[model samples]
Target: MDPQDGYDWQPQQTGYVPPQHRPRAQVPRVDAGRLWAGGAMTALVAALTAVVGLLLIRGVLGIPVFAPEGDGAMGDASTGVLAMGAAFAALVATALLHLLMLATPQPGTFFVWIVTLATAVMVLLPFTTSAPLDARIGSAALYLVIGIAIGSLLSAAGRSATRQDF
Candidate 1:
């Protein structure tokens, strides 16, 4: 038999063995409980802010809380509306965080971009709609405040909730 035929293809038994491939770092798992808690807190705060701001604008500043079409007053932007909107925003935000955590390597970074863009869209709604100038400004301010509160809180919550220990 030839010498080459008897040789094996296994790695050589040299004392200085080359290093094996290093496993990739583990991705952190997101804690949904903490995230949802933040969402709940944000929803409460945003809803409160909306109601208080609406009162200040309409009650204090004498700005009627009217529809975007410059129609009659909006019945004080009722608590039901504000609470439901805030809760809905929070839910949507939480869902988005869950998606990013599962599918994206950089969930926090993407989360910020997503929240910011959505807030910007919200901020622009009054201007594009048929709302009056004063009403538009007031509504836009409320939207800005609510968006900032929700976005910042949720993003922070998402960042803090992720861990490698899973």
Candidate 2:
């Protein structure tokens, strides 16, 4: 019998073993109660921001915004509309942030980008109107302040609502 064909032959074994794959990163969980609470706070802040901004522009500075100069400090019904609009915007932003948190990997980053772009649009929108330059500028400034308040406050709310999964 040939030695190569002999059944007594034993196979060589190596002690080295392949490493196991590392565990995947965990996704974050969102707390709806906390998020909505924070959103409500943000909405209140945004409404106040609109009211105060309008007062500062129309009442203190005596610049006509969202109405004629004859409309006085409060600038007519437009001021109320602006306040309601701001509150509504804040609620919409909250919904967007909530959706982003649930669907995206980097929710905060995306939220900031989205809000920033929306703010830019709002700030630029007044300039397109046929109103006087001062009115346009004042309105734009008011929109800017409102946008900032909403974006910053909602961002904080989103952060507070996120919980990291182990």
Candidate 3:
């Protein structure tokens, strides 16, 4: 070794291969059973979000939940109805995402755009309703929570549901 050279180099064997250059094994995609299970979990999440958000809006925020069509006065919002709506919304989102995954090449991106647009509509719904300002804001906040939960969970679940063959 010459003084100018920092270190000595050893020659590799004729057939030697570098570890980093080796191909990696592919991971198996999630099966349908797992996907459905995830969807069920998403529904549960939506339900819980609805319940908690509604409670916060009505109980903590002191904003009275009311029926939009009926007398525009402070009224009770059925916890059961809220929970059911959230769960149903999540289920529908999941189904739509699944269909998009099966049919489209870029399902995840498309799903995000779709959910975002839907959330925008939900946010705008309060302005159109005749409910009082506080109630409208509260309901819109609830919609935001539900929309976020549905969008994020359904997107992940849909990606998981995608077939490996694709």
**Candidate 2 segments exceeding 4 Å error:** 1-25
Using lDDT, give the best candidate's number: 2
- Tens digits of per-residue lDDT for model 3 on 1-166? 3244543433363453344434565543546676777888989999989878866766666777644333222234576787888888887887777677667767789889998999889888987978798888888888888899988887777766765542
- Give the Cα error of residue 82 in candidate 2, in Å: 0.4
Per-residue error (Å), model 2, residue 94: 0.3
lDDT of 2 by residue, 35-121 (tens): 999999999999999999988998999998888889988878898898999999999999999999999978999999999999999
lDDT of 1 at 30: 82
Preferred candidate (lDDT higher): 2 or 3: 2
Measured on C-alpha atoms, candidate 3 has an lDDT of: 0.74
Q: Count the backbone clashes (under 3 Å) in each candidate.
A: 0, 0, 0
lDDT at 164, model 3:
54
What is each predicted model's overall lDDT from 0 to 1?
0.75, 0.88, 0.74
For model 1, state the Cα shift of residue 145 in Å: 0.6
**Candidates' TM-scores?**
0.77, 0.84, 0.72
The predicted structure with the larger lDDT, 1 or 2, is 2
What are the per-residue Cα lDDT tens digits for candidate 1 across 86-151? 768977898898889889978889988888888889888889977668878887888888888888
Off by over 4 Å in 3: 1-30, 67-77, 163-166
